[model samples]
Target chain A: MHDSAQDDVTTMTFEAFADTILPGEKRFPGDVTVAGVAVGGGAVASGAVAVLRTDEGGMAPALDNLAEALNGHAGGYAAERGLSLDPAVPPFVALSFADRTELVARLTAPTHPERDIWVSVAMFSTIAFDAAAHLHTVDALADGHPGMTTMGFKPPEADGLWRFPEFSYGRQLARPHPDTTPSGSPA
Target chain B: MTAIESTDVVVVGSGFGGAITAYHLAAGGARVVVLERGPWLTGQDFDQDFKFGSSSTRAFDFTIGDGMSVLAGNCVGGGSVVYFAAMPRAPRFVFERHGSIGRRMWPAAISRDTLEPWYDRVAEALPVTRQDWSDVPYAGGLWAAACHHAGRTANPVPVAIDNERCVNCNWMMSGCRFDAKRSLLLNYLPAAIAHGARIRPLHEAQRLERSDDGGYRLHYTVVDDVDYRVEVGGGAIDAKVVVLAAGAGATPVILQRSADTLGPMPAAVGRYFSGNGERLNTAVIDEDRVREVLGLSRSDGVPYEAYQIGKGPCVATWDRLDGSLPEYLRYSLEQLYFPPGFGTILAQVPDATGPTWFGAEKKELLRHWKSWLTIFTMSEDDNEGVFGPPPPTGNAVRVSQQMLGRGALRYRPTENTLRGWAASDAEVRDILERDGLARVMPWTNDVVGAYTVHPLASCRIGDDPATSALDDRHELRGHPGIFVTDGSAVPGALTVNPAMTIAALAERAVPAIVEAARQRGVAVRYGAPAPDGATAARDAVLPLVAGRAGR
Candidate 1:
């Protein structure tokens, strides 16, 4: 899928980057529907990415830059590790989950130029994941956003004001806890 | 630039300092206008959802122009909106220290006796209260128990809250949606508004210039958005008297920008910045385990059981520092509470381990988010920071980096302050470990150069014009009509939350401010003066408290 503003190549690269950061066991539940389109709970969280790109433009350029530099990152990692590559240039988006993880770890090493790129990706991915899990309501059970069920995170609602009738609200000076028994004093 | 609006007095903040100043000045019959850089938020604006709540009400959204971060309130009420409603006065010893024989007449010229009346007045208005230990949450009880086990006397910390509305949600940092907190938004501001004080929110004062009319001209831009994008029309306000109450971090920047017009200020203008020796520590105590240690037999006592997180006042401090300092530099402890999501974030990174939120490890931490507790320690700190114009680079990112880089390179914690923090941490560690409550975790960030939410003492008030920014009257040493009434004017570290103290100083500064404006042919009258202006000045000051200039 692609928009006129964003090409298909950049979109796919972003999705791959997000999946590596948050590989949900299941799709997030899609409780939210826009224009009758049920949103959230997908293996590839395009909604999260779109929201993140809209909110934080600082990370948007890195998405495309990372895609363009993926081959360089793979080659440098291979050379540093003294490993030979099966293909001289591997497609990062098409790499297996294990290969992608290895590629990412190397790209984000302290000395690597792509470290900031990975940081931007990780930050956006988490924000998108949280938004999907917390915002959706309708297709929640069927949708596979693992963060919701696994972490037991719930969306906020108007539950009414919290009431503490027992509290005195400092009408008078409060004495210390009666249960406070000094270390050397009698229990 | 739009035409400048003229007024009798223009206060540059709306927190405790500005709010109190505006109320008193307005009551004194002067036309008072207050400019706040942040939004004017209402109770309905605050949310419990972490992201929404923080962005809307809790977060200050300011960086220290360095990598080091600072936490302050960015709403209409300022720090009072987000601070733990605790309102303990500065210890009598602090006032006496400046008046004592060895360092007599060196630091602050004011004494405790002069401030005692204003303290009582402020306490009555805010109506500070000490909570019954039974009313606090599980965290409070745990802190009390730790204090007892450590052989330190634990007393109930006083809070300024509306008992009728407080639910004790423990989300005080996020702003009180219930309007339980007696912040300036609820009290002083509204009173000032009723007395003809006009508050202009989202108006950030960028610089100041001496006016042709001899009053100060405050140049400011309206912040259409918090991110500094999309600016509206900019304007200036010409006031007979200008008071700087933008807190410690920002007040110095305002003054620095105005130096060309206001003439060279004392070298001490940006010097003496401090963090009030603030430090925070935490431990994850299993509810069942802690209860059992306290000899409470629950119906279903199980180890590692999670308890439902509820809200209450966030902090309860102990007055005595125990052995945290060498009989002089005092330390105090306050229990800190966070929103559940903050708890999750805190749990995710135990020791800055890289990315623990991917697989089962994430689930394990999120499951027990309710079991975490944070203990914060604050000690007296030396004034040790400087703020000036961002380098010529004009890049916001680069400026922040340079500020933090320079701050890191220049800052060296004094031996006494270091020993104070070390002693405070040891005391907290002893409390947690002695009872075997839970694992005491190491700090995720550097403890020595840890960033602080409480920064004070940038432009302190003193008798000497050469060494201090302001005179004993809280007026700028060289500039007569300009004044400072916020934490920037605080002479030294109070070693405690400085909200109440700031308000008390504002109360004390109002009389001189009104008199100064009146002398300039500005009739500064309270709503309607009592039979006697001097006596009325003594009573409520209606807002100003006039006192002996120097001790």
Candidate 2:
């Protein structure tokens, strides 16, 4: 188990990593974990950390190690570029948005030995923002998930079913089978 | 160890192959026992969420191999429970086509003409129907329109779904929550159960050994339904006949493991694998282009908006298998729709001016998520892939514990396959660009490798035991009572969804299996009457023609 201070750094590092992929505003005032770079809710705001912590995510056990690796990679990246690092916060969290993006690109490059791990992290981050993989579908829609809302997903009707009587092509291409019942099943 | 149970025939899966075979055999008065490795689930247990975890009844199971990733269903109803329900028959050429080795991949006995009766049998059981134009979802409509612009014809692919119950929720692949789709759970399994075929879900078949009574003994493990954790000791069953329908990825592993006790399997046990040239690509249509395609006038006063892709069934294929195109170039492009959650995970649209995966450009792409059209392409390819023991290093999934190591699939697309994909991609680009497009993106690349839901012909059936695991009669070579009748038995790529073809092959092979069971004094009957609604469903889809002509 990680100490509380180290855990906080890991959380901050993950937040920075997710925000770089799908950047968003800070969750609250004095929230240094999230980089307030973009306009709307991004992966961080969409519960990236919470998603990663889920048992189904399969990354909860490796959170600290991944954060440490990110920081180590960030350190090497900074040294190679002769760039100064911020003393405050973790190395990955301290880097500028542009530098963070470049570092991620390098990590996820085709020939990278650990590319699959980084790619998985990136996919999970994206999944959090897109599918809300950690949440129940109906509950997420009821709570107005930012990602689902942004994507303009159609919600279920009052009876919790989707019924589209309108034809997509504006005209019918063929008639329904004679055996088709009023309820849409073949009799 | 638990006391061994006895049955007349033991079927080792619950997918279309196993379920159909069980239904027929049980109806013929044979005591059938179906041992499914996954859990028995219903509509109430279904969800639209993308489940990637290892669950006993997850809608789909993914096995990452050496050069490809395989997607398969993991439930009582098997692939039928999770597939899109498109039931197109393999064209005549698919059966007659020769491989690069100058030999026909499929046996001369198997052809569209020969399989048509069995295909008709499955169609009726599943009650296959062609989607009416009114039922075509917006994404399908857009695809048809694009095909029309490209001087090609797009038709509604024949499917095994009830048109009325489907609400166009676009959750077909995740398993239908409304029980709208005509999965085997809705038809064959229930009929098999009614005929006294006992289905044992969560029973994972481990190995096969010859029983003392000149029958077969199937060793299996009973797993927890929730997490699929194995229990202690496991169990075994004795049967006069054992039918291996555990799918291409799994059946081969089982046979390979049984080799130690049952004697060495033929060399062709895990050869001739094919992904059916499956590829996923997407094209995002511009908003203005979308309105023009929909023929919206300025005076209509409605703001122009792109169609909601997730408002209908998963696929409506644009047929390009006509004789005009070369065999290598012939392919079908099915319009695909993913539910919003799964769709967003596939939102990586490459752009020349910006980062492909992240940044403002990606966010913008997400905003128009409804406008993006996903195309699932399938074409003819050489069945050159081989399933074998995993390498000493690298990533691979152990499909079965008996595999010793991971069940590795070594496949690199042949030059012909590469040309086919290129030709298909070029056609898609031309079609979409002519109408105007933001970006056309393919899901597979160097890093991701190839992904296929239709993995077929790992243990193919042919006339020669040197080149095929099973005889033309669907029996394992040199193993009289053991049979393979699943995607594994399909001799080559079908150039379409393999479900109907796999089911048809099983249907055709059942009579011979029944005769063998009868000769072994299992008191089996043959030519059992079709279950209720079988004739009606068959008559609805069959027009006495093979392939898409009936559709």
Candidate 3:
């Protein structure tokens, strides 16, 4: 079945969550730990995670448990976060972007039982961020986003011709026949 | 009271095999109707983005024994629409690999001589050529240098792409956006449609029954929608001749599903499955060299072109120099270029390493996107595997098993043959190290996700029904009007891209099929003789596509 994780993340909270995890312009230059501008806007990041989970499986249910844990009703995930006894706040779906990010960070903290949730969602989000923020254009990369361009990458011109300098080696390999046979050929 | 649509011939699965068969048969003047499970995707529908082509429904991704997923395209043009477009002819050693068995099956069932002309016809219809050094992106240069340093030949690999029209956007994996890649959608399917062939895109074949009128009755479903799960409704058709070209993975399941009504198949029905011994090895070159060598240095405000463009053709291939091993057993290296954006997330890595290397390390890899080059080694498999009784993984299994037999569809790769793929990886690393062009990545023995793009064998052809599924003519032995003509009919791996050979074999098989329909009193109009099939060449088959006519 198609994982509906993407459908769940299309709201403002997921976008805020994405931005918190990978803020494009929020972080200062050379400070990896510094905060950056928010990343998620469209359904791309969540959708990518959903797609990955569809093939890889397991991520969907973990996401479900994390969501439930945040609502403070089911799973010890919230209890471990010391929120199990707290009056059930708004459903994870209703939480604000900052609230959602805080909830996700706590759930995915190294000490948290559901840290793997961060791994799947974060990896997919990071990849999605590259495609959406950096790959399409340099404007996307330099808008406080660290990508290939930030590293001063000089990407190749895919349209024009450039000499390979090893053409002769290739031609030698493409030469014609020897009427060869298999190892077990009956001579 | 026949509650089904009828046609002169019903070709299942519009892939390289089915599409080519439809073209030849329709050209031959037979009333042809094709049933494809995927949508009729045009070039415009293809997107350059990473997630654009990752349709769960359109691209059939299923796992078999050991929980490793094997992928195959499910669109109208089948695998040809989603492959690397690398079209190398089966070498003599490939056909002569299994001793007498290979000899009989190779030349007798579908001779290279019979196929060379069809290959030419296909080439003429599509754009097949090799790119010199000037033809590819900077990544191509790395491959050429590595081959040269290793003292191996790096021949140009022929791809069905028109260089003139190609922008080298390198999004061939998601389907070509510029329409430069000559998939069957452009060539064979269009020709078939022009010649009066009916293509039903979302109509998937479900079951087969022998009609009372001595024809074949096919039960199918019209797919309403295919997202994460396949949503389908029932349908049916009747035809005098039924050609099964679903795929090596699906065709056996289709036949096995209908086995009760069709009676027993040979013991080798799902046996002899090969993964073509495919393996992937990647390395990172000096990031500065990408800009310095390719002249793609940073300008003031130019957008960083993170996508792979102009790297369309596989660029180069390195063959095994030592003639000691069988040609089929020999390994060849090809290069792969992924858009940096997509590579950051989806590129191959050591097994279970992706999740752990998040945040910084992942960013570091993305930072040097232009420096990474993935080399693929496609070695011919020894043909020892099966496809059936897999744990229910996806809808293809659930639905097909509901119609056919339970536990009838699974793909089992040969452990030993797969182990043999390790050397090819090592060889690629050695070449890279020798060239000093790049630093080799850690080798991952993740054969579970072992890619089988060129899946062949399973329902193979031979002279005996006891040992083989089909006869020398590609007829399903006991079943007169039934034929299996896709990659499943190949007895062994071609040691190269099998699309051209598969299409060529379909071209050769159709004339005989037309003759059979004629004997059955089906009115089939024989079109002009195929460009190559008409004039059978007596010369020894050349090495690859470039040797066939010329670049």
- The TM-score obtained for chain B by all candidates, in the order given, is 0.85, 0.89, 0.84
User: Measured against the native two-chain assembly using Cα atoms, what DockQ does each of the candidate structures obtain, in the order listed?
Assistant: 0.14, 0.31, 0.11
> Model 2: which docking level applies?
acceptable
lDDT of each: 0.58, 0.72, 0.56
Candidate 3: Cα lDDT at A94 = 41
Q: For model 2, what is the alpha-carbon lDDT of residue A145?
A: 81
lDDT per residue, candidate 3, B1-551, as tens digits? 54688898999999978987788678767889999877777776765533323332244433323312345777788887777787766665555556224444553545554556656655555546655545555455556555655665565566777766666556576577667777888777887888899999877776688987898988877764433234466567889999999888777767766777878767777777776766666676654543444333323321222224344435445456233774444766777654433224434333333232333333444455555677766676666666654332222443221111123333444544554466676777787755244566532333223456677788887765655788877888778899888998887766566777777677556656776777767776444433333322212222222221121
Report the Cα RMSD per candidate: 7.2, 5.6, 8.5
Candidate 2 backbone overlaps, count: 2
Task: Provide candidate 2's TM-score on chain A.
Answer: 0.85
Better DockQ candidate (1, 3) = 1
The C-alpha interface RMSD of every prediction is 9.3, 6.8, 9.8
Model 1 CA lDDT for position A145: 46
Which should have the higher TM-score, number 1 or number 3? 1
Give me candidate 2's TM-score against the actual structure: 0.89
> Across residues A67-96, which tens digit of lDDT does each residue of candidate 2 receive?
999999999999988888887889988888
Against the true structure, whose DockQ is highest? 2
Q: Where does candidate 1 stray beyond 4 Å?
A: A1-51, A54-78, A83-187, B52-59, B64-67, B95-106, B111-113, B225-228, B296-324, B327-329, B340-363, B391-416, B446-449, B464-467, B525-551
